[model samples]
Target: MIIVALDPPQNVDVEKWIKIRYDELKEYVQGFKIGVPAIIRVGLEGLSKIFKDYSGLLIADLKLADIGDVMALTASIVGDYGFNAVIAHAFVGYSQAVDELSKTCEKKGLKLILVVSMSHRGSEEFIDKHLESFVEIAKRVGSWGLVAPATRPLIIKRVRELIGSEVKILSPGIGVQGAEPGTAICYGADYEIVGRAITHSENVKQSALKIIENQKQRVAKCRG
Candidate 1:
């Protein structure tokens, strides 16, 4: 499962980025990730314009970090903006926040993907600091999925154990970060979110195909 991160900074040629990647953005990727840059460059209008022709899951990575009511409201607005899913900051908010966001998303049939961990250099300190507690919150809140680094083996196992196959995991840090899709799956990641690895490649299509090919090989190996 692929989740393409559309997170090129503002200076990047958004139109070119979209156009070049258009042909390759097929069912191979389960979702399109709209992070800070994409959201900023192409607001609701841009999103509407893109999704008008492109039909895949849209993930609004707002990473919302507010109270229960605010989180619910933000998620509702994002849903209204035609997003299939939105991200929430699991650490900052309370369980009630998750409940509220989940309820709102459920009403609109949208998904709330909780950011249990991010893929950055200093993430370990922040995540390891409150790993167990946050995992409990994630399980209790009942969001659609959790985002974490694909490289972290133990945390992924713990998360799966807590959720017991109910909650999905969207793991990033593949390719460019040195954790391939096969490696992530072997560690139990449900979906792979890739960005620069494909977007910045010399041949986007071939790059995507290679990653997909690698993923297939890995999945087969894991099953065997």
Candidate 2:
């Protein structure tokens, strides 16, 4: 799925911006992703008003790393508003409390995607240090997916090997972040989290379409 990260234009009417972007790009992409910062900027009430008519998967990138109750409550708010999934942090060691959060997410029916590694510079060492334990948390929590950085193809490959096919892998860092579009999927990603690559392009619809085309071309090349 091509998830368009919903970012509110700081100077414009955020509700209008969202509507325009979604309406324009929905046909080319599968879903939309709104991070915690964006949600906070517009508030859930504002977000609900704008997304009520959206038919695709709505992902809330909570990336929560707090205690269990806080995570549960945050997820309650996200699920209540109709988000299909939410991302969480698994860097902390597993325990009964985290298991409780897992139960809460399952009860809410929101898919839990754990962030394994980030895209920007300087995150490698930290993620590498904690990678093994994070995978353990992911397995214990019944996570639906895992976040892998497209910028690092081997990391995706390693994650695919370690976690296998049961866990869906979502990758970011395509286009503007310098990772080639579709290449992540070649390595092991199931979806690419594209943002500025499309959003900042001169033409949003065309940019979105090109992302899909790029992926398809990659697939064709691999098969050939």
Candidate 3:
């Protein structure tokens, strides 16, 4: 399950790459990740046009961190705009905004993926320490999925253990960030969220295909 993190800086590139990737690499990956950067540059409505017909999973990586009601409204907008799933932060705790956001997504038919840990440096200092709390919150909210950083193998294993078969673990921080392919899922990830490695490659399709192949072999091994 490879999700292309489509994050081109310019609006023109965003649209261009989206069509190309969705057309060429749709079979190679399970879905596509549309982050805030792309949404901001192109505006939700503008981006919506490109994704409106894209029948695959359109995950909005908004990382929504706000009051439950506010976050729910924001997610509702994304859902209205055609996004089926959304990524949000767990740092906000599990009661008000975070909890409400989950319920809102349920009512709207939007899948929620909570961010428990990050791939970048320095994030581990805080997120790593609170891994248990984050996983617990993610479970309590009935998240459809959870975000884990591939760069941290130990943490990913811990996360998988805590959550078990409750939710899908979507991991990022691969390729350019240095976490090797065929590795994260072995540790626990159900899906991989990759960006620059494929989008920035001279041959985007090939890079994506390689990831798809790696994921297949890894999954087979895990099953065996």
Alpha-carbon lDDT, every model: 0.77, 0.82, 0.86
Indicate which candidate wins on lDDT.
Answer: 3
Which 10 residues in a row give candidate 3 its minimum summed lDDT? 9-18
Q: Which residue pairs of candidate 1 clash?
A: none
Score candidate 1 by TM-score against the native: 0.91
Candidate 3 runs further than 4 Å off: 10-12, 219-224
Mind giving the per-residue lDDT tens digits that candidate 2 earns over 1-224?
57788766567776777777888898778778998768888788888877888787788998888878888888888889878788887875567445666888899988888888888777676876677678778988888988889999888888888888989889889888898878888898888889878876778888888888988898678657
Candidate ordering by TM-score (highest first): 2, 3, 1
Shift of residue 37 alpha carbon in model 1, Å: 1.6
User: Deviation in angstroms for 210 in model 2?
Assistant: 1.3
Candidate 2 segments exceeding 4 Å error: none
